[model samples]
Target: MRHRRSIDLMPREDAADDGATLELLPEWYVLVAKCGKCRHQGRIDRRLVANRRGWGVSLNSIGPALKCVRCGNREGNKLLLGRLPRD
Candidate 1:
């Protein structure tokens, strides 16, 4: 079974009386994983890439990647990687 997930690559605004355009920066990429069989949705942080080297990899080599916690799907598991906007 395959599941579809919706990932928000935009910043979310909080409720405020001020009309100013507030830009919230996320520390990491937010990933939304959904189950196709049950339609269950879940979210995971993409910061895991930082620890890839496991020993001492330079921060420059670490790129942005997201994984699905629910479906065990990797960033390259499907074409969803390109769908995300570049920072």
Candidate 2:
């Protein structure tokens, strides 16, 4: 059986009420992605997210579809979301 992980998508839900829709999330905030396989983690720019839309990913489901640069895993739904540290 495959392991199932829970991710906190609450921030995005909260952001949505503040006019920060997923499609425009990158414009307003930076996102952190953690790999489910190798556990690799990194920051993903909002523009890159916007670009992902062009590849057919819907805004609502982008989180779980992200690929891990280190492991190339596609089980994005299990990916956690966190705020990037301010510069």
- What TM-scores do the predictions have? 0.27, 0.53
User: What overall lDDT goes with each candidate model?
Assistant: 0.33, 0.54
Pairs that collide in candidate 1 are 2-36, 3-35, 3-36
lDDT of 2 by residue, 1-87 (tens): 222223333334333233334554443344667677787877777567667565344444666777888878888434334543447
Off by over 4 Å in 1: 1-29, 49-87
Q: What is the lDDT of residue 5 in candidate 1?
A: 26
Global fold similarity of model 2 (TM-score): 0.53
RMSD of each: 13.6, 7.8
Best by lDDT: 2
**Candidate 1: worst-modelled 10 consecutive residues by lDDT:** 13-22
Clashes of each: 3, 3
Model 1, range 1-87, lDDT digits (tens) per residue? 222324443212121222321122133434344443344445433344334533243222222233445665544322111135557
Model 2's number of clashes is 3
